[model samples]
Target: MAPGVGGAITGAAAGKFFSWLLESERARPPRVFVSFDFDNDQQLKHLLIGQTKRQNLPFSVVDGSLKEAAPEPRWKEAALKEIRRCDVVVVLVGRYTYKAPGVLAEIAMARSEGKPVVQLIGSRSLGYTRVKGAGKVLAWTQDNLTKLFGND
Candidate 1:
């Protein structure tokens, strides 16, 4: 090997090195798209949004969640666009989440886009239902959230 030639990463090696750096343990915080039963779970969504401002959370909630009670036509299209830009979709499961057409539609959109979905138990009610097919409903804990978004 020529002197100093082996000292630097170049070409394919450089590309690989860069990739490794990006995928390393210190990868950027995952962008999260939050979904919830807007009719009854707005406060829960806001609670999660508040966590983004803290430095200890593992993910950053992306803006552009639908805030209106009555979505205009093509709202799903807008939702899908936002979902596509995020790393994961977090559905805040609530009492009426299953009955929330918008939440269900958002979940379907996330699934169709191949985005990972994380279901968090956002309600303390006795019969708060989970969003079907969204996988397990996990507790609202920093540890669990970190495990999901920490290195992804």
Candidate 2:
């Protein structure tokens, strides 16, 4: 076999070998699925949402006319489906709001799905408890998250 192909096969074998070693800890840390909008909340939502996109990991966000004056229940279904598919759910909490009721529902659904949760706060507004299974809640500024995630 050519050297390149030989190296490729060897690397694949090594990868598979290492993958098997971590099979027992599959439930730890977990895959993260994030939810938010770009234009709607801007800062908080944008920060976490932006970092997720930059990471190139598998994640989904609310899309389409869900931002309409009156949202359809189907939007909730779609969002929950994404939340259900992930092992972790990260939400962005922002200001000038009572909080996004829909996103909150998504978090609850993630809990129902047995996914750990994480949140990055975009504002200083207080008066909420971290979700029970959430891993970490960071006071992340939108710009800082963008830079830290290397999306800046």
Residues 12-131, model 2: lDDT tens digits: 999998898776445333445665433346555555556666765333443322444455478777667666655556665544222556566676777787876667665566544454
For every model shown, the clashing-pair count is: 0, 0
How much lDDT does each candidate structure score?
Answer: 0.82, 0.56
CA lDDT of 119 in candidate 2?
A: 71
Worst 10 residues of 1 by lDDT: 64-73
Q: What lDDT does candidate 1 reach at residue 89? A: 94
Q: What is the Cα-based TM-score of model 2? A: 0.51
Q: RMSD for all candidates, in order, please.
A: 4.1, 8.9
Q: What is the Cα root-mean-square deviation between model 2 and the actual structure?
A: 8.9
Instruction: Write model 1 residue lDDT over 34-134, tens digit each, in one string.
Output: 88877788888888888767657877898656667455556787888999999899998888887788888888888999999989988676468767878
